[model samples]
Target: MTDMPLGAPGQRSVLRSLWQTQRVWLASATILAALAVFDPLQAAESAVFAVGALLNTAPFLILSIAIAAWAGATGADNLIAKAFSGTPLLMIGLGALAGGISPFCSCGVIPLIAALLAMGVPLSAVMAFWLASPIMDPSMFVLTAGVLDLEFAVAKTLAAIGLGLFGGTVVHLMMKGGAFADPLREGVGNGGCGGAKMRAPRPVVWRFWADADRRAKFGKTALSTTLFLAKWLMLAFVLESLMLAWIPAETITEMLGGDGLVPIATATLVGVPAYLNGYAALPLVGGLIEQGMAPGAGLAFLVAGGVTSIPAAMAVWALAKREVFAVYIGLSLSGAFASGLLFQLWTSMT
Candidate 1:
């Protein structure tokens, strides 16, 4: 009936796309299968731990999902779009402040940055947003509180805003002195490479439930957010269980637990390379904390990894000139270390 023989092409394409998205979950399943074959008891234990952990996180997970969905349905990013049109100094500060709270993901930042640049927003303000956006968000705040604590979540939010201010100020001065002449790479603002998370601004409807379209949008956002968070978190919990079973606590303590700044520095460095998915890293760090890793090291690793993580780096590299990328990386590393040091001092004091 169809022109295509065997009908395999379309089916294969769908299957391949699914596999790419599900590979992490597949890996978790594979790990369980292997464990079951070799150590059935341990496999059961891991499964139990993962389920329990997920259950414990369910409240935070629900709240985060709801927040993300609400933002999408109500178009809260309209506020972010409006924040860019002002004096350069004011714009930069506003940009960083907005970025710290914005729900823009790594994928979203690409199009948002490109859009801002194309609209003639100054580089300093854009840089502030770029630097801080990945550091924190509303859903991230809720999840961090659930995984870590309320105090930690608040500290990270402050760190995100502070880093934005710090980076924005430096970049603003540099631009004044004739650095970063032509920051964008060729054809960056022309378009984006898909996976855009921020939609164009629309008027916020406080009662999204009243509108059928908004209700559908909310459901769609919730489902997608849930799946994305679920996969990474599932993989993270599995890895954490294995790390607990296999890796000795003494090793984690020796490497990342200490009074001086060495552990924080080490964490900052290590996070740039060793960090995995943002959601996935949470439980691993929590596991490390349980193993006596210094809280400061944990915070440093999170900030450094969140900012310079592969997705964030690749987006910058693909969109901006090399110098811009350099400054971004430099700021991220330094800011992460400073956040850790301050957090450590605070923890020690209190």
Candidate 2:
């Protein structure tokens, strides 16, 4: 039989599927092409800047994805469950701490939360973990340090824990008031990732590599995560380049430069509707900082974006009642504002 041509139906279907999954890459490429057409010199400079940013953060990105893959393959969620299976108060505290270190994005956390709720984990514990997980992670910390500074990264990590604690306490108090008695909306179990089920805990060493299925799982998870992050990082760097090339420094400074409460509040508000991933936000924030955006405002923006971004909120809404969803939003917004203000004060004093 003759060899089929590359343009056969099978190949066409495969290409279509690839494009659907990686539309961000296609979109970014289209935008870059347009930029090149409009201004070739600026487009070349922007491409260089974007590539440099990607190179600078590649190590941390790889490390984070590897860790996340290992955790997924080795059943890290079960470990989280065991750690939080103590007293309600202890669960809350430990859950908050776990949230800080867990390698999950906001949307990625929804499945875990659904699993925990289905398993009868305390709402307080779930609340703590849910509130904090999106804001920081081991990989996110390193990425933040690479893009911004160690101080900002450390402060953001601390803020994630603080916000989790605050959220836990509030949920606990509300539970006492007979609120959130039945927080899960219908079909929550059907929501989020279908494959997020917790497996039997295994050793975190070489066991994942030992089993063929586990190895495949790890590889698949890591590759998908790397590609996902790369897409966002590319877009973020391009936007950063545009901001640097076009937006006047004085404009950014005038809007978000001050240490005052107004500027901080504005940043927080802006972040709520802005659709920036945690990793992607770093480069944009770095650009803003270089243009004199206040450290406090930048911190606020990160917290707010992580907490209230559309994807995160949509996940919350899908799994919870309107009232519980409102509380989630309220807690996130309040925590973001408070953390930003405190960070500002600390930065000023030092």
Tens digit of per-residue lDDT, candidate 1, span 55-162: 766765676567656755776544544555557788888889988998767545555565565445567888888888888989889999999999989988988888
Q: Kindly report which residue pairs in candidate 2 clash with one another.
A: none
lDDT of 2 by residue, 13-33 (tens): 989998977776887788789
Q: What's model 1's overall lDDT?
A: 0.76
TM-scores for every predicted model: 0.61, 0.61
Q: How many angstroms is residue 30 displaced in model 2 relative to the true structure, after the best TM-score fit?
A: 23
